[model samples]
Target: MELVLRSYCDLRLLLLLLGFSAGAVLSRPTDEGKEVWGYVTVHKDAHMFWWLYYATNPWKNFSELPLIMWLQGGPGGSSTGFGNFEEIGPLDSNLKPRNTTWLQSASLLFVDNPVGTGFSYVNTSDAYTKNLDMVASDMMVLLKTFFDSHTEFQTIPFYIFSESYGGKMAAGISLELHKAIQQGSIKCNFAGVALGDSWISPIDSVLSWGPYLYSMSLLDDQGLAEVSKVAEQVLDAVSEGHYQKATQLWGKAEMVIEQNTDGVNFYNILTKSTPTPAKESSLEFTQSHLVQLCQRHVRHLQQDALSQLMNGPIRKKLKIIPEDHSWGGQATNVFQNMEGDFMKPVISIVDELLEAGVNVTVYNGQLDLIVDTMGQEAWVRKLKWPELSKFNQLKRKALYSDPQSSETSAFVKSYKNLAFFWILRAGHMA
Candidate 1:
């Protein structure tokens, strides 16, 4: 029987954001198998809930394998959604009969995080933006409880793997764990980290994204030239303290999507989709339906995009539109803004971990024009670690240039215990 561990986040909005409803493990395989869920009390008034899955004596053998903590970014994304759906779930090929849960070798933990994401809720806006340090502390509390409950993992090395905005949390949280272990406040056995298509540093990322896009022909030479001109103008405007102009310049270049036979509709754009299990619906589509087509393809984004952009529930507060041409300058500036405020704590924390001999990896997918590979590249270059030297791939260059994570160009660098990889053709989830 397969063992699956599930964790949840409780954004206790009413009870001062302190109470978390724990997750429970259901449908155990054997008579002796055990699955449990509940809260791990953190502070005197705070609790972090989690669920566990395991055979009652699965570890009666040996317990030295790694424990992996998986995170999916969005600052509000659910690991169970993407991580389970795309990466490593028990079901595959449209959730058809497949058992892919490799539970015996290592432990996998997935958490729904932040105050406003998933089933998690926070009472007010002020409490929600509580920052990365607070999140790290919460993770520490949860992990501590986990280790205490599973005595086998007390001294076993564990690693954190995350993608996208999660890189911010992974890097920051690892640093906090390092500090805790170092100061003798907590005893943690941490190994290394692996990040795929992450968003760690954006400024430098913007610069590197261009070359990758050009090489892959995601942007033609002519398009590259135009992008360069616009990028320079935008960068200069941003540097010279021209916020509005910079954003406008950036948007002009940002909206360009490759045209296709279908004319920018669902069939034309590259997005993740699985075959409908057992033929459920039928609909004929055409180019004229591009607007509705895209809306249908990305329903999740369409539903919450406005809510996130507006900052809260639709009924409670209506956001006053800024005089700017863009709607509060999303798609281009929101990540930058959030990185400055919500992401710095984690950045500093990751740096601290690096200083403590902990391995940190940061990577990005190349063809993702939305997240902008240039931004990720710029961020890495700024690291300026003398030991970090680029090793670009020679074989499969076309794959690297392609905008598919499965097929993309890549580069690698190593600095001390830290390793960084940049994927050629991926997106934010890369």
Candidate 2:
């Protein structure tokens, strides 16, 4: 009887060991306290720099965290420089800790994408992205390689967050990423996307610019008519696949509207443009703060870790060889001028994302003229969603709160899986 009892105990212990082994194999590795700073090589000479910040509370498990990939506007802008320092990061201009940073609950990644923005660079000018599709493809490869290297964060809910021209880039990249995930090429969990004052659907966005100015009483009927005429010319150029002409014409028409207005501020329309202190450049201050932040990295990652071993060395090696001629990302912005369908409609893509059960939050400052709340709501009403009429009919709720409490909160409306927030007395920087 004693021998039989001993054998049963051994069998139970064996089963327990097997269960432990299985759990170890299936579970994702935890990256609670880690930071990653590296480059992602997308083309022969294109390298995109990325700096990822882990959630502030490292004690919390990784599964509770949401990872946000932040992209700044501008077809030629730098996400790391502008988005990180000026907009959202750990510190304010005074070098003090930000009271309410997105970093509190989420893991944020600031990438200098498109191969030439910020610290990212291109060894060859020919490899620059020319169109939205090329930019999307390059970003997709970067995401794939980025995830492949850091498998521990694959299970976290990921989001693409952007503003301005970067919003357009995010829209395109989100579609490509959706396809890759469906094809099993990308195994990460994609949660949703958010756009702030996005440059989406040029047809809808640009068409309303003149009318927006007109409604604000900034332009007279005759001036409005002239602006509309220029807009129509822009539409004609875009229709005929002359994107460069459209871009230039659009710029001229926008300038006319700006000149007509009360010194239009892209950031906040209600306020006058303030002069910067002559002694201090914002770039210098941001760079100064970054110097300390980078040095604090526990283990500095190198560029070779991001290279994909597809070609002999083009994609696999980190080549910092400088060309005799370098224009940062000017060539890419120049090439984008001629991109045939770069400014095409993106509402359909957004509609598809909403239908796929992705959460989309679009918040705009009420005072912004570049991508005004009026124009955004107009386009939102036009989207072919299931509850389009209901959403359009849904009354916005006005919330009154102290600026310090909620920071001038305003009207809000939600329908289906999408929501829009109109920030009070805010502008493009909202």
Candidate 3:
């Protein structure tokens, strides 16, 4: 029997907002003149909630700043719940300003993605589909409508960034936006995409984890052998086109590693035997923070009143019986039956983007066991680009971190518009 470690195959590293210079910043809102939060009716009953964050510090031409739209991973997770509340949003748990918030430079838009994730909701259960195309199309509709309403942001340089499965959505969205731009359907700078320890290919990522665990000394000879044996079964399942089964079997090997390691946190083994699974955060605590932000920051925003800002109609349609407890994590089992959803050819997509002169960067935390650096490196190697061979030949140029846990805490190598950072001693946004 497969040990089935909790949420093993799902790895989400909250991505960094690009274009932030090392400039001093204040925590007040920059675009205080604009609407801070709103909902878009992506479908008849599916409403996606979005909160805008200006560069935390004051800037003269804040409207000219690049825009970054962020999504959280779960195939069903909420960017509002995780990315904004738990990870990189402007506020701390008590709704106080977080000194390290990424909004210090780049403006951010965090939406509870797909349909059912976060504050986003659909009227009917059947309205939910986890396929990339449907979600991407809805994203297009939402974005078009957003730009139409807020014409000022339409021409700004826009970026799509995601963690985990959001990265999957970002890929499809990027391609769609490219086409839309050519057709003159959208009027945005449409920069590129950044993925944080995202799940690119189930096959490549799954096959890589066991060997990485072995190298980390978490797997002994017997554990390594068992993992390898299970990996073969996973490979067969994938080749047979059993995507769901392949995902299950792929997770089995890591589950075995966990069993042998006495249930260490797959995210960061050093975190020690925390009974809570390594891949998840405490929903209660995370939600508490989210509620605080909504009440404190959003409630006091300018344009709309508190009731209007909270959006009772959308909330009512969402069928959220409770007040604020409604926001938290979600398991996207809808993906199990979706073909090609487990593994899209993101490698090829990255290549296409690079060829088209789009700046693309994919980075992984070194200590991230959920999406181990080894697995990320393996997949990056498989990227079929003209300069790929040359990229591989170059050593990872030494990198520094003021917060680095080690002397050589990170290293990066880049060619043209593509760069990958291997952060040392970091876990999947833990």
Top candidate by TM-score? 3
Off by over 4 Å in 3: 1-35, 272-325, 328-340, 343-345, 403-406
Per-candidate clashes, comma-separated: 22, 0, 1
Query: Candidate 2 lDDT (Cα, whole model)?
Result: 0.62
Error of 3 at 342 (Å): 2.6
TM-scores, all models, native as reference: 0.60, 0.74, 0.79
* Residue-by-residue lDDT tens digits, candidate 2, 1-430: 0011112222222222112221223233445454567777898888777878776643455556678898876555556555654556665434467655656446788887666665577766677777778888888888898899878679988888887667777877888888889899987888777777887766566678778877777778887887687778778977887765566565555545555564554445555432322221112223333222222110011112211111123222324323442323342442243245545667887787777677677767677766777668777877877867787788977543432355334666777667776766656755
Candidate 2 ranges with C-alpha deviation above 4 Å: 1-34, 58-63, 93-95, 272-342, 398-408
Q: Per-residue lDDT of 1-430 in model 3, one digit per residue for the tens?
A: 1121112111111223254432334344354533266778888867777777765446535565667898776566656545664566776434566556656446788887777665666666667665778888888888887778778787777888777667767877888888788899987788778877777765666677678777878778887787677778778887887765565554555555566677666556565442323322112223333333223212222114222323444345445434532443222322322323655446676667777777777877666665666767777787877888888788777643433344554567877678787766667653
Residue pairs in collision within model 2: none
Distance from true location, Cα of 320 in model 1, Å: 37
Compared with the true structure, all predictions reach lDDT values of 0.46, 0.62, 0.62
Which of the two candidates, 1 or 2, achieves a greater lDDT against the reference?
A: 2
Candidate 3 TM-score versus the reference:
0.79
353-373, model 1: which lDDT tens digit per residue? 666777776655544544455
The stretch of ten residues in a row with the least summed lDDT in candidate 2 is 297-306
Q: Which 10 successive residues of model 1 have the least lDDT summed?
A: 9-18
